[model samples]
Target: MTTLEPAAVADLVRNTLAAHKSLFLATAGSTGPWVGGVYFAESGEFTLNLVLEDRGRTLAAIRENPVVSVVVSTGSPMQPFLQAQALAEILGRDEDARARELLVTKVPEAAPFLAAPVTAVRLSIRKWRATDIANGVLPGAELPSPRLP
Candidate 1:
């Protein structure tokens, strides 16, 4: 088993985010836990920006419970993995411009569909767990919530 310092862990997380464009977001809805794959962009340190339908189940679930879980992986065994619990803040229409811009810039194909009836959600990571077994960091390690930017 290998170990990683907090700074290294943070860097690893950032690198993982930079290498991936989408993550699995899990939220608790009135019905139950709902998971959705959303394209994301790192808006700031420890903050991720994603757009979702304003009236979609994911957004609805976020409104009901602002705390959500997110996972980013390559669908491979355990080489790259990041799981985080974050506080979800639904951006108001007026405040979502930047988020939309970031998303569109990262995913140009999504531009036309980002118009009205859609809004941005910022996930502020609270606690996180990560591992890169392929790199020899076996098992995994959980880190305390890093400082917010």
Candidate 2:
């Protein structure tokens, strides 16, 4: 069994988001169907930005089921064997105004997109978990005897 330090977990989340420019967002539609997409970011935040029109299923899903999961990976085919996989989970909904503001930071290219009908949302992270797949153990598994930061 492995243990992950708080700092290590935070770093993994940040690095994973930064390294992977695109994210596969999964959402539920009005009828309880799963919808997913590859979305670009204008910046890194607990929240994400996308064209509202493009997220018909997502929006409806959020309305019906606000609970959602976001998976950010290294996109490495060798990830499984490595024992350490970097990923983050964001749970919540995006607030239009707040999401738009944050989006501008990561994706300045969305300036025009903001004006174009869009729904901005934020994912409030209720709980987060990170692991070092390479270690073949959970996060923080190999702690130094001294427990150095």
Candidate 3:
């Protein structure tokens, strides 16, 4: 089996996430785990910023449990992958305008939702597991988690 250093993978993940516009977010609701595709704007520290419906299941889940998982694949599934479990902070309406501006800048289709009542959620990446899919191994197989402050 091939092995990768956590720090190297972590840097690669940061760069890759910065290049991608969307990610797959996984959250748990009362029923069970649910996944959604969301377009996001990243913070300089790699935190993910996105606007979510205030009454949506993801908001409910975040309110109930602030830990969420995310997966971002570069270019294609066969490329490098970055997976992490992050801390979710549900932002108040006061932050909506800035969040909406950031999101709409990347995904223009989200402008309509910004007109509606929505809450912005920021996912602060804690640790990541990475893999290179070209080698046919699980992206985040058994590498040490690269934690962020």
Candidate 4:
């Protein structure tokens, strides 16, 4: 099995968060079911911003069970493609002001949404893993192989 170095994984995670402005957040619903929602994410040292409608199901689920998982795909349908999935054990309660600031940075178009009544959930990523399928796993480095004869 191919595995990336910690540093490499961290870099990849950072870049993926930066590249993809939005992420799919998955949480357990009140009825013991799984639910997913799209939200604009703002990456941080160990946490990410999940901005959503204040009275939406996503917010309700988070309120019930703070734990959540987020998927940041490469937006490629190809199999074994590079992707970063993070499992975050959310901490504390929603912070509207901070969430608005981060939302503005990540999604300027979301300014209106941020201005409106919304909930900002902070996700503290406890464990996360990233894989580079196209390029072989390396330690803190990404290099494309040159064509050979």
Instruction: Please provide, for model 3 over 1-149, each residue's C-alpha lDDT reduced to its tens digit, 9 standing for 90 to 100.
Output: 45566565657667677777888889997868888887888765457799777788888888888889988875476787778788889877677667778888877887787878778888888766777767654635533334565
lDDT of each: 0.84, 0.50, 0.75, 0.59
Instruction: Please give the RMSD to the true structure for each candidate, in Å.
Output: 2.0, 7.5, 3.2, 8.4
Predicted structure with the largest lDDT when compared to the true one? 1
* Candidate 3 residue pairs in backbone clash: 131-139
Q: Between 1 and 3, whose TM-score is larger?
A: 1
Q: Best by TM-score, which number?
A: 1
lDDT of 4 by residue, 17-133 (tens): 777766667777676656564556655635677666667777777778777766666555331222223343333444656666777877787787766666666666654555455
- lDDT order, best first, reads 1, 3, 4, 2
Give per-candidate clash totals. Answer: 0, 21, 1, 0
Model 4's alpha-carbon lDDT is: 0.59
TM-score of 4: 0.73
Give the C-alpha lDDT of model 2: 0.50
Q: How does each model score on TM-score?
A: 0.90, 0.62, 0.78, 0.73
2 versus 3: better lDDT goes to = 3
Q: Which scores greater on TM-score, model 1 or model 2?
A: 1
Candidate 1, residues 63-89: lDDT per residue as tens digits?
999999999888786658888889999
Once fitted onto the true fold, the runs of candidate 3 whose alpha carbons sit more than 4 angstroms away are 1-7, 74-76, 135-149
